[model samples]
Target: MFAFAVGDSLVALDAVKIDTTDQARILRGGQHFQQTCLSCHSLVDFVNDPVAKELGLSKEQMPVWPEDSWNGHPPPDLSLIALSMSPDWLFTYLRTYYVDKARPTGYNNLVYPNTNMPNPFVDMQGHQVLINPNYFDKNHAHGEQFWYRVIKLKETGRLSPAEFDDYVDDIVQFLTYVSDPSVHARRQIGPWVLGYLTLFIMVTYAYFRLVGKDYFQSPKSPPPH
Candidate 1:
């Protein structure tokens, strides 16, 4: 369980960074996510198919990845992965896939060490290896901060470093949207629902003042007998 630091050059992602709202990026991310992640992790909501119309992607363009036959135990469901794990975690995790030839998949994560998973986008982002891991003192760093802060790429891959970051960002954005497809509609309908409730309360109060109690007073108990 390695913790990430703010100024660490190896994992340069910010914990407080915001997710991108660009529709194009988000849509592209949905494509990549379907291509890579869905192969292992099943999205629980795909049976209803909210992703296509909501994200402006078609079923053909973003078909779900075929069921994985590579591993015996199925990977964890990813329906809420983005929500449970923040966008920064997802982004940083996606980008910091350093090479470790000893592992079965030949890759280990910077954020989560000794991980069993492989880098799905290895060709696009390339491979990296740890550099200085000297900050191992108890008082130096703890909790969410690790001593290591650098990694050097051993081999270059298809996409340049900058392009890979942008690609990962787009995927993160799509995952954030996938967590809650109804968020946009909810926001849109929220104001109207509030307005209707307010109007109902005002109308009910007006009715009470005008004729509600006066017309039904039980004749004041027959003038107190």
Candidate 2:
């Protein structure tokens, strides 16, 4: 399991670091998700997330999705996605969608081939095409490494490349926060916890020094007696 997870994380090294603490950005992501993903994907755990509540996000505001499935493919709940799949993996997967008419969804992903989830950011991210669609066999025998080299943006989208990246990053950050709602409280208290430990250690050391001199030190020689 460790190696399997690590292999997934190594899929893309270019993934940008996410700042989950940015409440404003997380809010933007949450709103965008409500508009786009919530129509199909449900975040059951996130509905009761304290951080999400503080951000004024409510599941009641989301559109009701079918209880059965989405086109025979039940959309997976994404509440724990950022934990099950690394943020880097999610970020890369979202950014690496390429046009594939062969698929029913008219899209495919580099990280996950033949993904059931449609390209949610197509309008903002624009169309990406494989530079060499024929280089590999129909079976995709060449694997993921080749896919990384072949995908290229064919048309500019509403958002510039950089803007699109930031947009995706925000969404990924929001997911990450949802995975571990306690993160905000932990980060906020971490510094104070360390400070308290440091102070305790220092006081303990001072007391040790003050008492050790009398307890451990040899008595002064009695004037050469």
Candidate 3:
């Protein structure tokens, strides 16, 4: 299994490509969410969120998990997370969690240090760790090492590497869409708003012409009272 841990001086967050319009991917991610992530993270602002409807989801179809039982700490709400973080940040963060002995969650992330969050899909992604951090790179910098990685799978799970990448992309897309659910509503109404403005401009132009007609015609002065 080949996996990449993105961080360090050489890794660029912009390199990860994700398409938000892939409806199938987004839906798959939603399903994955139900099965995995919902058990930890809560989408508390979901009451006003409109993206679910846009994604063809119903409230009844969704289930809210109890607060996370891990370490007695409740997981953070995911409502505005995508809005706060960059896509590349999300991309790197999701894929970078590796097994760590010191952490209570038994995992650490290259992007986020000492994070308590455990990788729920670890079985599917297998395990990943950084490559030789001390390899000499005179061409770059003396103290810094480029992000190289090696992923070894002791056991296989449901998804393959490519499928897992798509899964991550969709999850990011869904979360991003959820961040500002009103954007979908705006997108839907944008064309109608523009059409209304177009018609209004034409009507206003005609009205202006009518108002100007008296200016072109003979002027009439009223008699002094």
Candidate 4:
């Protein structure tokens, strides 16, 4: 009997940091997500008056889960997925779907193998096939070694690779914003907060030098005792 534990099969793909601060970009991503991902995924926590206003969308414009579950797996609420999995992971995962005849969906993700969700962007992303789908680890550290998958577009999609990357980046940014809408406000106030703290430190040091100097200074020779 052989028991092989495939530990952390998902290979983390490198992605450039997304700018969640770009409201226009985030709005584009939100709209795109509403058109695409809303059919299966939900963002209950993200749908609010503030968020809608921030995204320049009405309540009706916000995405809703149309179905209870996708296939057997409840397509998981994606409200916090960006936070849970990271923007890089989502950005990579969305673009990494490759054709896999063995899989039920005829697509498998390099970031998430045997995923139940079908490739939603198949038309936009076109067909992709793994170059050399094999598993090997020289160290074989109990499946701890990272698994990498190489892929190339077998058929071109609506968008070119660069365009696709930008598209995916926008979506990732939107998801990141949805995960934490307060980021905008936080970023806006961060410099002010830091400035106030710096000023406070300077004022405190000066006050200590001027007023507290007496406390810190050596007392006058007491009666020359």
On TM-score, the candidate that comes out on top is: 2
lDDT (Cα, tens digit) per residue for candidate 3, span 100-182: 67678787765655666787778778876545433223254421332333323444557887787777877887777677666
At residue 90, candidate 1 shows an lDDT of 78
What is the full ranking by TM-score, best candidate first? 2, 4, 3, 1
TM-score of each: 0.64, 0.72, 0.68, 0.69
List where candidate 4 sits over 4 angstroms from the true fold: 1-7, 54-68, 133-149, 188-225
How accurate locally, in lDDT, is each candidate?
0.64, 0.76, 0.63, 0.73
lDDT of 1 by residue, 44-147 (tens): 65435445555444434433443464354345666677787778777777777777776788987766555566788778877777664442232333224431
Model 2: number of backbone collisions:
0
lDDT for predicted candidate 2 compared with the true structure: 0.76
Clashing pairs in 1: none
* lDDT of residue 76 for candidate 2: 74
**Which candidate number has the best lDDT?**
2
lDDT tens readout by residue for model 4, 1-225? 112112333554665587866889889888888788876676777766365566555445434543454554557777888877777668777887888888888998766767788999887889988666553223333323232336778898898988888888888888898899888778889999999999999999999999998998899878954
Number of residue pairs clashing in candidate 1, backbone atoms closer than 3 angstroms, sequence gap of 3 or more or interchain: 0
Q: Which ten residues in a row have the lowest lDDT in candidate 4?
A: 1-10
The lDDT of model 1 is: 0.64
Per-model tally of clashing residue pairs: 0, 0, 0, 0
Q: Which pairs, if any, clash in model 3?
A: none
Instruction: Give the Cα error of residue 7 in candidate 1, in Å.
Output: 17
Per-residue CA lDDT of candidate 2, range 84-150, in tens? 9788778888888888989999998777766778999888989999887774455443234633577
